[model samples]
Target chain A: MSQTMPDWSVLAATCPSRTSLARIANKWTAMAVSVLGGGRTRFGDLKARLDGISGKVLTETLRDLERDGLVTRHVFAEVPPRVEYELTELGFTLHEPLLALCRWAEEHIAEVLVNRESYDAR
Target chain B: MSQTMPDWSVLAATCPSRTSLARIANKWTAMAVSVLGGGRTRFGDLKARLDGISGKVLTETLRDLERDGLVTRHVFAEVPPRVEYELTELGFTLHEPLLALCRWAEEHIAEVLVNRESYDAR
Candidate 1:
């Protein structure tokens, strides 16, 4: 029933998920989302969990995720204005696939690196 | 044993495949690679199989795939100078995942679209 769209091939052909995939699959996004997946997490804690992400990028990615409906942002009325982020249902559905991709990447890192070297020499 | 790199989390967090994923997961790259996967295909033939891809983008993607060692390019010595492209072993490894992603996209497209609408309205 839902297979009638024009962009269907985009996912089937290239993995339509590629577009938003970058958001969660990105270096910061993945870590940040993963951290949030455990439960709602504060921005500062997320920053700490994901080492080396700049405040600017973190804020930007979070905003993007929120905009895309993948993540929900909650702001508490308190001193310093406490804020938290958590995955929406749609975002949660991506867990298994994202985890699988990660595991695959981790398992195949050596091979991918080796391949990269071989490819570079060519 | 291979989970020692700093970038390990990138795949685990976001999906390391995101980088090369874009190459194969792009509109042109996906269709082109899929067509090439069947066997070695001429550039014009691939262009035909994948509708709407410009000659410029197709050439560029093929070049990128070749540079990344995902696809091999063959040039035949002939009056017309025949050329062909096909996936390398590494590129072939992506078949299952890529197919799965595409299928998922096709299957869940309506939901994604619905979600998109809802998101946009918010």
Candidate 2:
């Protein structure tokens, strides 16, 4: 478990939010969160949505999301057992910003590509 | 030097933007960019704006910013030598989103603090 430091500094410090930022900026996390934005989803469903993510990394990301309070995980007691994850209100709040980033990446991708060619040619 | 793969995959990959996201999400980067939003600034000026950053880390961060093209560095021929950094248009474009994150952090910081306490107690 990570140490729980005082609240004031966590908000003030960049290191603390580095983890959160990493989570949001992660390819899998962003895609997972975006897919979850549709509604609640099971682990397998999420795995299907994001192709090529190792099971280990996916599990780790999910745990981080739960720990950070961005997503809620509910486990059911049954024969096959069921687990579901969904975004909290706070998580939902992050959607617009994350979406904005995705939109920016999509829109400026061509420009960024052009810049890369010029940047590399030099 | 980090490997420069094809341009398309970079925009598509999470790992690539992880560096850029990490750069923007960094406490110092946010603060530095915010300060630079005022206009061009000297290296020492940026160091002053962000407290507690070591010179090495600051230099590294500046290099990263320049490499990513978020900042432009100008060196002057003089007795003492003068260097300045200012944001590019793309860097300026990133300002609003970064500011939004800072504003969100400031506003919800109290709520996040409360959540932390409750979360720890459990």
DockQ of each: 0.24, 0.16
Q: What's model 1's lDDT at A44?
A: 92
Cα DockQ of the candidate 1 complex: 0.24
Please list the residue runs of candidate 1 whose C-alpha ends up more than 4 Å from where it truly belongs after superposition: A1-7, A11-37, A48-52, B1-7, B11-39, B48-57
Q: Candidate 2 lDDT, tens digit per residue, B44-100?
A: 877876656678988887776666677888999986999999998987877776556
Which whole-number lDDT from 0 to 100 does residue B122 have in model 1? 75
Instruction: Point to the candidate with the largest DockQ.
Output: 1
The interface RMSD values of the models, given in order, are 5.2, 4.7
Against the unseen true structure, what C-alpha lDDT does each candidate score?
A: 0.65, 0.66
TM-score of chain B of each: 0.75, 0.79
Fnat of candidate 2 is 0.01
